[model samples]
Target chain A: MVDWLTMTIQMASLAMAGWCLVSTFRDQPMLVPHLVGMGLLWLLVIGQGVVSAVALIGGEGPEETVMYVSYLATVVLLPPACAVWGFMERSRWGPAVIAFACLVLPVLMVRLEQLWNPVV
Target chain B: MSDTTAPGRALRTGPGRLLVAVYSVFALAATARGTYQLATRFDEAPAAYLLSVFAGAVYLVAAVGLARAGRASRRVALVSCAVEAVGVVTVGAVGLLAPSLFPDDTVWSGFGAGYGYIPLVLPFLGLWWILTVHRKDRARAV
Candidate 1:
Protein backbone atom coordinates (compact mmCIF):
# COMPACT_ATOMS: atom_id res chain seq x y z
CA MET A 1 0.00 0.00 0.00
CA VAL A 2 1.02 3.59 -0.68
CA ASP A 3 0.51 4.45 2.95
CA TRP A 4 3.00 1.85 4.06
CA LEU A 5 5.56 3.03 1.52
CA THR A 6 5.08 6.63 2.58
CA MET A 7 5.56 5.74 6.23
CA THR A 8 8.64 3.72 5.43
CA ILE A 9 10.13 6.57 3.41
CA GLN A 10 9.37 9.04 6.17
CA MET A 11 11.07 6.92 8.80
CA ALA A 12 14.07 6.27 6.59
CA SER A 13 14.38 9.97 5.85
CA LEU A 14 14.26 10.81 9.53
CA ALA A 15 16.91 8.22 10.31
CA MET A 16 19.17 9.65 7.64
CA ALA A 17 18.65 13.11 9.00
CA GLY A 18 19.48 11.99 12.52
CA TRP A 19 22.63 10.38 11.26
CA CYS A 20 23.57 13.57 9.43
CA LEU A 21 23.01 15.69 12.54
CA VAL A 22 25.20 13.41 14.65
CA SER A 23 27.90 13.44 12.04
CA THR A 24 27.71 17.20 11.76
CA PHE A 25 28.15 17.70 15.49
CA ARG A 26 30.96 15.17 15.48
CA ASP A 27 32.56 17.12 12.59
CA GLN A 28 32.63 14.61 9.81
CA PRO A 29 32.18 14.71 6.06
CA MET A 30 28.98 13.38 4.51
CA LEU A 31 30.23 10.17 3.02
CA VAL A 32 28.90 8.47 -0.09
CA PRO A 33 26.49 6.41 1.95
CA HIS A 34 24.83 9.50 3.29
CA LEU A 35 24.40 10.88 -0.19
CA VAL A 36 23.01 7.62 -1.46
CA GLY A 37 20.53 7.44 1.41
CA MET A 38 19.25 10.90 0.57
CA GLY A 39 19.03 9.99 -3.10
CA LEU A 40 16.86 7.01 -2.31
CA LEU A 41 14.65 9.13 -0.12
CA TRP A 42 14.16 11.62 -2.92
CA LEU A 43 13.24 8.83 -5.29
CA LEU A 44 10.64 7.63 -2.89
CA VAL A 45 9.20 11.11 -2.56
CA ILE A 46 9.04 11.45 -6.32
CA GLY A 47 7.21 8.18 -6.56
CA GLN A 48 4.77 9.31 -3.92
CA GLY A 49 4.23 12.55 -5.75
CA VAL A 50 3.34 10.75 -8.95
CA VAL A 51 0.95 8.47 -7.15
CA SER A 52 -0.72 11.35 -5.35
CA ALA A 53 -1.05 13.34 -8.54
CA VAL A 54 -2.65 10.43 -10.34
CA ALA A 55 -5.03 9.83 -7.50
CA LEU A 56 -6.00 13.47 -7.43
CA ILE A 57 -6.63 13.52 -11.16
CA GLY A 58 -8.59 10.34 -10.95
CA GLY A 59 -11.12 12.02 -8.67
CA GLU A 60 -9.79 10.91 -5.32
CA GLY A 61 -10.65 14.49 -4.40
CA PRO A 62 -7.73 15.68 -2.33
CA GLU A 63 -9.00 17.88 0.51
CA GLU A 64 -7.10 20.86 -0.80
CA THR A 65 -5.63 20.44 -4.21
CA VAL A 66 -3.52 23.58 -3.95
CA MET A 67 -2.01 22.63 -0.65
CA TYR A 68 -1.50 19.05 -1.77
CA VAL A 69 0.27 20.18 -4.92
CA SER A 70 2.45 22.57 -2.95
CA TYR A 71 3.43 19.80 -0.56
CA LEU A 72 4.26 17.56 -3.47
CA ALA A 73 6.44 20.17 -5.11
CA THR A 74 8.29 20.93 -1.92
CA VAL A 75 8.91 17.28 -1.08
CA VAL A 76 10.15 16.42 -4.52
CA LEU A 77 12.59 19.29 -4.67
CA LEU A 78 13.91 19.09 -1.11
CA PRO A 79 16.50 16.39 -1.42
CA PRO A 80 18.12 17.56 -4.62
CA ALA A 81 18.26 21.13 -3.41
CA CYS A 82 19.86 20.06 -0.16
CA ALA A 83 22.29 17.88 -2.02
CA VAL A 84 23.44 20.75 -4.21
CA TRP A 85 23.75 23.16 -1.28
CA GLY A 86 25.44 20.59 0.95
CA PHE A 87 28.02 19.67 -1.64
CA MET A 88 28.97 23.29 -2.07
CA GLU A 89 29.86 23.92 1.58
CA ARG A 90 32.41 21.10 1.88
CA SER A 91 32.69 21.39 5.65
CA ARG A 92 30.79 20.33 8.72
CA TRP A 93 28.00 22.43 7.30
CA GLY A 94 27.57 19.91 4.52
CA PRO A 95 26.38 17.29 6.95
CA ALA A 96 24.41 19.98 8.74
CA VAL A 97 22.50 20.68 5.55
CA ILE A 98 21.67 17.01 5.35
CA ALA A 99 20.56 17.11 8.95
CA PHE A 100 18.22 20.00 8.36
CA ALA A 101 16.72 18.42 5.25
CA CYS A 102 16.26 15.18 7.11
CA LEU A 103 14.48 17.00 9.90
CA VAL A 104 12.06 18.60 7.46
CA LEU A 105 11.11 15.34 5.78
CA PRO A 106 8.82 14.15 8.53
CA VAL A 107 7.14 17.50 8.80
CA LEU A 108 6.37 17.46 5.09
CA MET A 109 5.06 13.93 5.29
CA VAL A 110 2.74 14.89 8.11
CA ARG A 111 1.47 17.83 6.14
CA LEU A 112 0.92 15.63 3.12
CA GLU A 113 -1.15 13.25 5.20
CA GLN A 114 -3.21 16.10 6.57
CA LEU A 115 -3.89 17.40 3.10
CA TRP A 116 -5.08 13.99 2.05
CA ASN A 117 -7.45 13.66 4.98
CA PRO A 118 -8.22 17.09 6.38
CA VAL A 119 -10.53 16.88 9.39
CA VAL A 120 -12.09 20.27 8.83
CA MET B 1 39.73 43.41 4.70
CA SER B 2 42.78 42.88 6.88
CA ASP B 3 40.50 42.37 9.84
CA THR B 4 39.06 39.40 8.00
CA THR B 5 42.61 38.18 7.53
CA ALA B 6 43.31 38.42 11.25
CA PRO B 7 43.73 35.18 13.15
CA GLY B 8 41.02 36.07 15.67
CA ARG B 9 38.42 36.77 13.02
CA ALA B 10 35.75 34.21 13.64
CA LEU B 11 35.39 31.71 10.88
CA ARG B 12 32.04 32.04 9.23
CA THR B 13 32.97 28.68 7.88
CA GLY B 14 31.26 26.21 10.16
CA PRO B 15 27.78 25.78 11.56
CA GLY B 16 27.18 29.36 10.52
CA ARG B 17 26.92 28.23 6.91
CA LEU B 18 24.34 25.68 7.96
CA LEU B 19 22.33 28.44 9.55
CA VAL B 20 22.26 30.27 6.26
CA ALA B 21 21.26 27.10 4.51
CA VAL B 22 18.22 26.60 6.72
CA TYR B 23 17.22 30.23 6.44
CA SER B 24 17.40 29.96 2.68
CA VAL B 25 15.06 27.00 2.76
CA PHE B 26 12.54 28.91 4.85
CA ALA B 27 12.82 31.85 2.52
CA LEU B 28 11.94 29.71 -0.46
CA ALA B 29 9.09 27.91 1.27
CA ALA B 30 7.47 31.05 2.62
CA THR B 31 7.78 32.82 -0.69
CA ALA B 32 6.22 29.99 -2.62
CA ARG B 33 3.41 29.54 -0.16
CA GLY B 34 2.62 33.22 -0.09
CA THR B 35 2.68 33.54 -3.84
CA TYR B 36 0.45 30.57 -4.32
CA GLN B 37 -2.04 31.71 -1.70
CA LEU B 38 -2.16 35.23 -3.02
CA ALA B 39 -2.69 34.07 -6.57
CA THR B 40 -5.30 31.41 -5.93
CA ARG B 41 -7.18 32.36 -2.78
CA PHE B 42 -6.58 35.99 -1.98
CA ASP B 43 -10.19 36.57 -1.04
CA GLU B 44 -10.14 33.79 1.51
CA ALA B 45 -7.56 35.29 3.85
CA PRO B 46 -6.10 38.48 2.51
CA ALA B 47 -4.55 39.66 5.74
CA ALA B 48 -2.97 36.34 6.66
CA TYR B 49 -1.77 35.75 3.12
CA LEU B 50 -0.23 39.22 2.90
CA LEU B 51 1.53 38.62 6.16
CA SER B 52 2.89 35.42 4.68
CA VAL B 53 4.22 37.41 1.76
CA PHE B 54 5.89 39.88 4.11
CA ALA B 55 7.41 37.07 6.14
CA GLY B 56 8.81 35.58 2.98
CA ALA B 57 10.35 38.87 1.96
CA VAL B 58 11.97 39.32 5.34
CA TYR B 59 13.35 35.79 5.27
CA LEU B 60 14.80 36.37 1.82
CA VAL B 61 16.38 39.68 2.77
CA ALA B 62 17.79 38.30 5.98
CA ALA B 63 19.28 35.31 4.22
CA VAL B 64 20.95 37.51 1.65
CA GLY B 65 22.20 39.89 4.31
CA LEU B 66 23.76 37.08 6.32
CA ALA B 67 25.35 35.53 3.30
CA ARG B 68 26.99 38.75 2.07
CA ALA B 69 28.77 39.49 5.39
CA GLY B 70 29.68 43.04 4.43
CA ARG B 71 29.14 46.09 6.64
CA ALA B 72 26.01 47.12 4.79
CA SER B 73 24.74 43.56 4.67
CA ARG B 74 25.18 43.19 8.44
CA ARG B 75 23.16 46.33 9.07
CA VAL B 76 20.44 45.12 6.71
CA ALA B 77 20.41 41.76 8.39
CA LEU B 78 20.06 43.34 11.83
CA VAL B 79 17.09 45.41 10.71
CA SER B 80 15.47 42.46 8.97
CA CYS B 81 15.92 40.24 12.00
CA ALA B 82 14.37 42.83 14.24
CA VAL B 83 11.40 43.13 11.92
CA GLU B 84 11.01 39.37 11.75
CA ALA B 85 11.07 39.04 15.53
CA VAL B 86 8.42 41.70 15.95
CA GLY B 87 6.27 40.29 13.18
CA VAL B 88 6.31 36.74 14.52
CA VAL B 89 5.47 37.79 18.06
CA THR B 90 2.69 40.10 16.93
CA VAL B 91 1.19 37.69 14.44
CA GLY B 92 1.45 34.78 16.80
CA ALA B 93 -0.43 36.66 19.49
CA VAL B 94 -3.04 37.89 17.09
CA GLY B 95 -3.63 34.48 15.60
CA LEU B 96 -4.00 32.92 19.03
CA LEU B 97 -6.28 35.59 20.48
CA ALA B 98 -8.28 36.27 17.32
CA PRO B 99 -8.36 33.00 15.46
CA SER B 100 -11.41 34.07 13.47
CA LEU B 101 -9.47 36.93 11.95
CA PHE B 102 -7.17 34.52 10.13
CA PRO B 103 -9.32 32.51 7.75
CA ASP B 104 -6.25 30.47 6.98
CA ASP B 105 -2.87 29.92 8.58
CA THR B 106 0.18 32.03 7.90
CA VAL B 107 3.81 31.36 8.68
CA TRP B 108 3.61 33.25 11.99
CA SER B 109 0.40 31.68 13.17
CA GLY B 110 0.74 30.75 16.81
CA PHE B 111 4.43 31.64 16.62
CA GLY B 112 5.08 29.27 13.77
CA ALA B 113 3.55 26.41 15.72
CA GLY B 114 2.92 24.65 12.44
CA TYR B 115 6.60 24.84 11.64
CA GLY B 116 7.84 23.72 15.05
CA TYR B 117 8.24 27.34 16.23
CA ILE B 118 11.27 27.77 14.03
CA PRO B 119 10.03 31.13 12.84
CA LEU B 120 9.99 32.36 16.41
CA VAL B 121 13.50 31.07 17.08
CA LEU B 122 15.12 31.87 13.74
CA PRO B 123 15.15 35.65 14.12
CA PHE B 124 16.85 35.44 17.50
CA LEU B 125 19.47 33.16 16.05
CA GLY B 126 19.97 35.44 13.06
CA LEU B 127 20.46 38.48 15.25
CA TRP B 128 22.80 36.58 17.54
CA TRP B 129 24.88 35.35 14.65
CA ILE B 130 25.09 38.81 13.13
CA LEU B 131 26.16 40.37 16.42
CA THR B 132 28.64 37.61 17.12
CA VAL B 133 30.22 37.98 13.72
CA HIS B 134 30.36 41.75 14.06
CA ARG B 135 31.95 41.51 17.47
CA LYS B 136 34.60 39.23 16.10
CA ASP B 137 35.32 41.75 13.35
CA ARG B 138 35.61 44.56 15.88
CA ALA B 139 37.94 42.57 18.10
CA ARG B 140 40.11 41.74 15.09
CA ALA B 141 40.30 45.47 14.30
CA VAL B 142 41.92 46.07 17.66
Candidate 2:
Protein backbone atom coordinates (compact mmCIF):
# COMPACT_ATOMS: atom_id res chain seq x y z
CA MET A 1 0.00 0.00 0.00
CA VAL A 2 2.68 2.46 0.97
CA ASP A 3 4.78 1.40 -1.96
CA TRP A 4 1.93 2.06 -4.40
CA LEU A 5 1.32 5.50 -2.96
CA THR A 6 5.01 6.29 -3.06
CA MET A 7 5.21 5.21 -6.69
CA THR A 8 2.18 7.28 -7.61
CA ILE A 9 3.64 10.32 -5.89
CA GLN A 10 6.93 9.84 -7.71
CA MET A 11 5.17 9.58 -11.05
CA ALA A 12 3.15 12.68 -10.40
CA SER A 13 6.24 14.56 -9.34
CA LEU A 14 8.06 13.44 -12.47
CA ALA A 15 5.24 14.62 -14.68
CA MET A 16 5.13 17.94 -12.89
CA ALA A 17 8.87 18.27 -13.18
CA GLY A 18 8.75 17.63 -16.92
CA TRP A 19 6.02 20.20 -17.30
CA CYS A 20 7.94 22.69 -15.26
CA LEU A 21 11.06 22.20 -17.35
CA VAL A 22 9.13 22.77 -20.55
CA SER A 23 7.32 25.77 -19.11
CA THR A 24 10.55 27.31 -17.91
CA PHE A 25 12.19 26.90 -21.26
CA ARG A 26 9.15 28.39 -22.99
CA ASP A 27 8.95 31.30 -20.52
CA GLN A 28 5.54 30.45 -19.13
CA PRO A 29 3.98 31.81 -15.93
CA MET A 30 3.49 28.34 -14.41
CA LEU A 31 1.28 29.65 -11.64
CA VAL A 32 -1.67 27.26 -11.95
CA PRO A 33 -0.39 23.81 -12.85
CA HIS A 34 2.68 24.11 -10.70
CA LEU A 35 0.53 25.08 -7.77
CA VAL A 36 -1.81 22.15 -8.27
CA GLY A 37 0.97 19.63 -8.73
CA MET A 38 2.89 20.94 -5.78
CA GLY A 39 -0.20 20.92 -3.59
CA LEU A 40 -0.86 17.27 -4.35
CA LEU A 41 2.77 16.41 -3.83
CA TRP A 42 2.76 18.13 -0.46
CA LEU A 43 -0.23 16.09 0.66
CA LEU A 44 1.45 12.88 -0.46
CA VAL A 45 4.64 13.73 1.37
CA ILE A 46 2.73 14.53 4.55
CA GLY A 47 0.88 11.25 4.34
CA GLN A 48 4.16 9.40 3.95
CA GLY A 49 5.62 11.25 6.88
CA VAL A 50 2.68 10.33 9.09
CA VAL A 51 2.86 6.66 8.16
CA SER A 52 6.59 6.57 8.71
CA ALA A 53 6.29 8.26 12.08
CA VAL A 54 3.64 5.82 13.23
CA ALA A 55 5.73 2.89 12.11
CA LEU A 56 8.74 4.29 13.89
CA ILE A 57 6.90 4.72 17.17
CA GLY A 58 5.40 1.26 16.84
CA GLY A 59 8.78 -0.35 17.49
CA GLU A 60 10.62 -0.01 14.25
CA GLY A 61 14.34 -0.78 14.41
CA PRO A 62 16.38 1.94 16.08
CA GLU A 63 19.26 1.52 13.63
CA GLU A 64 17.22 3.13 10.86
CA THR A 65 15.20 5.49 13.02
CA VAL A 66 17.33 8.58 12.61
CA MET A 67 17.58 8.29 8.85
CA TYR A 68 13.85 7.70 8.49
CA VAL A 69 13.00 10.60 10.76
CA SER A 70 15.31 12.97 8.98
CA TYR A 71 14.02 12.01 5.57
CA LEU A 72 10.44 12.33 6.79
CA ALA A 73 11.04 15.80 8.14
CA THR A 74 12.63 16.89 4.88
CA VAL A 75 9.76 15.52 2.83
CA VAL A 76 7.26 17.29 5.05
CA LEU A 77 9.03 20.63 4.84
CA LEU A 78 10.14 20.70 1.19
CA PRO A 79 6.90 21.46 -0.64
CA PRO A 80 5.70 24.48 1.32
CA ALA A 81 9.16 25.94 1.41
CA CYS A 82 9.45 25.63 -2.36
CA ALA A 83 5.98 27.08 -2.81
CA VAL A 84 6.89 30.22 -0.91
CA TRP A 85 10.12 30.59 -2.78
CA GLY A 86 8.57 29.90 -6.17
CA PHE A 87 5.82 32.43 -5.58
CA MET A 88 8.38 35.06 -4.68
CA GLU A 89 10.03 34.71 -8.08
CA ARG A 90 7.64 36.18 -10.66
CA SER A 91 9.52 35.05 -13.77
CA ARG A 92 9.82 31.78 -15.66
CA TRP A 93 12.23 30.96 -12.91
CA GLY A 94 9.18 30.38 -10.73
CA PRO A 95 8.53 27.16 -12.57
CA ALA A 96 12.20 26.44 -12.64
CA VAL A 97 12.18 26.36 -8.87
CA ILE A 98 9.24 24.01 -9.02
CA ALA A 99 11.19 21.87 -11.44
CA PHE A 100 14.11 21.72 -9.10
CA ALA A 101 11.81 20.75 -6.24
CA CYS A 102 10.20 18.10 -8.38
CA LEU A 103 13.59 16.71 -9.34
CA VAL A 104 14.44 16.31 -5.69
CA LEU A 105 11.31 14.22 -5.10
CA PRO A 106 12.46 11.17 -7.00
CA VAL A 107 15.89 11.29 -5.41
CA LEU A 108 14.26 11.51 -2.02
CA MET A 109 12.00 8.57 -2.83
CA VAL A 110 15.01 6.55 -3.85
CA ARG A 111 16.66 7.37 -0.57
CA LEU A 112 13.53 6.36 1.31
CA GLU A 113 13.45 3.05 -0.47
CA GLN A 114 17.10 2.43 0.36
CA LEU A 115 16.38 3.12 3.99
CA TRP A 116 13.40 0.81 3.93
CA ASN A 117 15.32 -1.99 2.28
CA PRO A 118 18.91 -1.63 3.30
CA VAL A 119 20.01 -4.91 1.75
CA VAL A 120 18.94 -3.86 -1.70
CA MET B 1 9.18 51.00 -8.70
CA SER B 2 11.85 51.54 -11.34
CA ASP B 3 13.22 48.27 -12.60
CA THR B 4 16.62 49.76 -13.19
CA THR B 5 17.10 51.03 -9.67
CA ALA B 6 20.10 49.62 -7.83
CA PRO B 7 21.27 49.02 -4.24
CA GLY B 8 18.84 47.54 -1.68
CA ARG B 9 16.51 46.63 -4.48
CA ALA B 10 15.43 43.11 -3.63
CA LEU B 11 18.56 40.98 -4.04
CA ARG B 12 16.64 37.75 -4.01
CA THR B 13 13.84 38.48 -6.43
CA GLY B 14 13.09 36.62 -9.65
CA PRO B 15 15.13 33.48 -10.43
CA GLY B 16 17.75 34.45 -7.90
CA ARG B 17 15.28 34.01 -5.08
CA LEU B 18 14.81 30.39 -6.05
CA LEU B 19 18.49 29.77 -5.52
CA VAL B 20 18.20 31.35 -2.11
CA ALA B 21 15.26 29.10 -1.28
CA VAL B 22 17.18 25.97 -2.25
CA TYR B 23 20.15 27.12 -0.23
CA SER B 24 17.91 27.80 2.76
CA VAL B 25 16.43 24.32 2.60
CA PHE B 26 19.88 22.75 2.48
CA ALA B 27 20.99 25.00 5.31
CA LEU B 28 18.20 23.85 7.59
CA ALA B 29 18.50 20.18 6.68
CA ALA B 30 22.26 20.04 7.05
CA THR B 31 22.13 21.89 10.36
CA ALA B 32 19.55 19.54 11.80
CA ARG B 33 21.29 16.43 10.53
CA GLY B 34 24.71 17.57 11.68
CA THR B 35 23.41 18.49 15.12
CA TYR B 36 21.62 15.21 15.51
CA GLN B 37 24.62 13.15 14.46
CA LEU B 38 27.01 15.12 16.63
CA ALA B 39 24.84 15.00 19.73
CA THR B 40 23.86 11.36 19.42
CA ARG B 41 27.17 9.74 18.46
CA PHE B 42 30.20 11.99 18.40
CA ASP B 43 32.49 9.07 18.98
CA GLU B 44 31.37 7.29 15.85
CA ALA B 45 32.79 9.76 13.34
CA PRO B 46 34.02 13.05 14.70
CA ALA B 47 35.62 14.29 11.48
CA ALA B 48 32.62 13.68 9.25
CA TYR B 49 30.16 15.11 11.76
CA LEU B 50 32.19 18.22 12.41
CA LEU B 51 32.48 18.84 8.69
CA SER B 52 28.72 18.43 8.45
CA VAL B 53 28.23 21.06 11.12
CA PHE B 54 30.59 23.44 9.39
CA ALA B 55 28.84 22.93 6.07
CA GLY B 56 25.53 23.67 7.73
CA ALA B 57 26.86 26.85 9.27
CA VAL B 58 28.16 28.00 5.90
CA TYR B 59 24.80 27.32 4.27
CA LEU B 60 22.92 29.18 6.99
CA VAL B 61 25.14 32.22 6.83
CA ALA B 62 25.02 32.27 3.04
CA ALA B 63 21.22 32.00 2.98
CA VAL B 64 20.79 34.76 5.52
CA GLY B 65 23.25 36.99 3.74
CA LEU B 66 21.63 36.51 0.33
CA ALA B 67 18.15 37.08 1.69
CA ARG B 68 19.16 40.27 3.44
CA ALA B 69 20.18 41.99 0.14
CA GLY B 70 22.52 44.81 1.06
CA ARG B 71 26.16 45.73 0.41
CA ALA B 72 27.30 44.06 3.55
CA SER B 73 25.02 41.15 2.93
CA ARG B 74 26.41 40.68 -0.55
CA ARG B 75 29.91 40.60 0.81
CA VAL B 76 28.90 38.09 3.41
CA ALA B 77 27.20 35.88 0.86
CA LEU B 78 30.18 36.06 -1.44
CA VAL B 79 32.54 35.12 1.34
CA SER B 80 30.35 32.29 2.49
CA CYS B 81 30.04 30.89 -0.99
CA ALA B 82 33.78 31.10 -1.45
CA VAL B 83 34.35 29.26 1.77
CA GLU B 84 31.72 26.69 0.82
CA ALA B 85 33.33 26.09 -2.54
CA VAL B 86 36.74 25.58 -0.98
CA GLY B 87 35.33 23.37 1.72
CA VAL B 88 33.45 21.13 -0.68
CA VAL B 89 36.46 20.64 -2.92
CA THR B 90 38.91 20.11 -0.12
CA VAL B 91 36.69 17.81 1.90
CA GLY B 92 35.66 15.92 -1.19
CA ALA B 93 39.29 15.36 -2.14
CA VAL B 94 40.19 14.31 1.36
CA GLY B 95 37.24 11.93 1.55
CA LEU B 96 38.27 10.32 -1.68
CA LEU B 97 41.94 10.08 -0.73
CA ALA B 98 41.39 8.77 2.78
CA PRO B 99 38.01 7.13 3.32
CA SER B 100 39.14 6.17 6.80
CA LEU B 101 38.87 9.79 7.95
CA PHE B 102 35.08 9.67 7.64
CA PRO B 103 33.63 6.66 9.40
CA ASP B 104 30.22 8.10 8.67
CA ASP B 105 28.81 10.43 6.01
CA THR B 106 29.09 14.18 5.77
CA VAL B 107 27.23 16.37 3.31
CA TRP B 108 30.40 16.86 1.30
CA SER B 109 31.39 13.23 1.45
CA GLY B 110 32.52 12.09 -2.00
CA PHE B 111 31.72 15.54 -3.34
CA GLY B 112 28.10 15.26 -2.26
CA ALA B 113 27.84 11.99 -4.14
CA GLY B 114 25.04 10.82 -1.86
CA TYR B 115 23.11 14.00 -2.64
CA GLY B 116 23.63 13.91 -6.40
CA TYR B 117 26.65 16.22 -6.40
CA ILE B 118 24.44 19.24 -5.80
CA PRO B 119 26.70 20.31 -2.97
CA LEU B 120 29.64 20.46 -5.32
CA VAL B 121 27.69 22.40 -7.93
CA LEU B 122 25.78 24.69 -5.59
CA PRO B 123 28.67 26.82 -4.41
CA PHE B 124 29.71 27.63 -7.95
CA LEU B 125 26.19 28.58 -8.88
CA GLY B 126 25.80 30.69 -5.77
CA LEU B 127 29.05 32.50 -6.35
CA TRP B 128 28.10 33.15 -9.96
CA TRP B 129 24.70 34.51 -9.01
CA ILE B 130 26.09 36.81 -6.33
CA LEU B 131 28.79 38.11 -8.67
CA THR B 132 26.26 38.62 -11.43
CA VAL B 133 24.05 40.65 -9.11
CA HIS B 134 26.99 42.71 -7.96
CA ARG B 135 27.99 43.38 -11.53
CA LYS B 136 24.50 44.58 -12.35
CA ASP B 137 24.56 46.90 -9.38
CA ARG B 138 27.91 48.31 -10.40
CA ALA B 139 26.73 48.88 -13.96
CA ARG B 140 23.71 50.74 -12.69
CA ALA B 141 25.85 52.95 -10.47
CA VAL B 142 28.20 53.79 -13.31
lDDT of each: 0.80, 0.81
Candidate whose TM-score is highest? 2
**Runs with alpha carbons beyond 4 Å of true place in candidate 1:** A54-63, B1-12, B95-104
Interface RMSD of 2: 2.5
Residue pairs whose backbone atoms clash in candidate 2: none
Give the alpha carbon lDDT tens digit for every residue of B62-96 in model 2: 98888885788888888999999999899889887
- In order of appearance, the predictions have TM-scores of 0.83, 0.88
lDDT for residue B87 in candidate 2, whole number 0-100: 91
Q: Which stretches of candidate 2 lie over 4 Å from their true place?
A: A54-63, B1-10
Per-residue C-alpha lDDT of model 1 across residues B69-137, encoded as one tens digit per residue: 456777887899999999999988988788898879988899999888999999998888777777777
Model 2: per-residue Cα lDDT at residue A57: 78
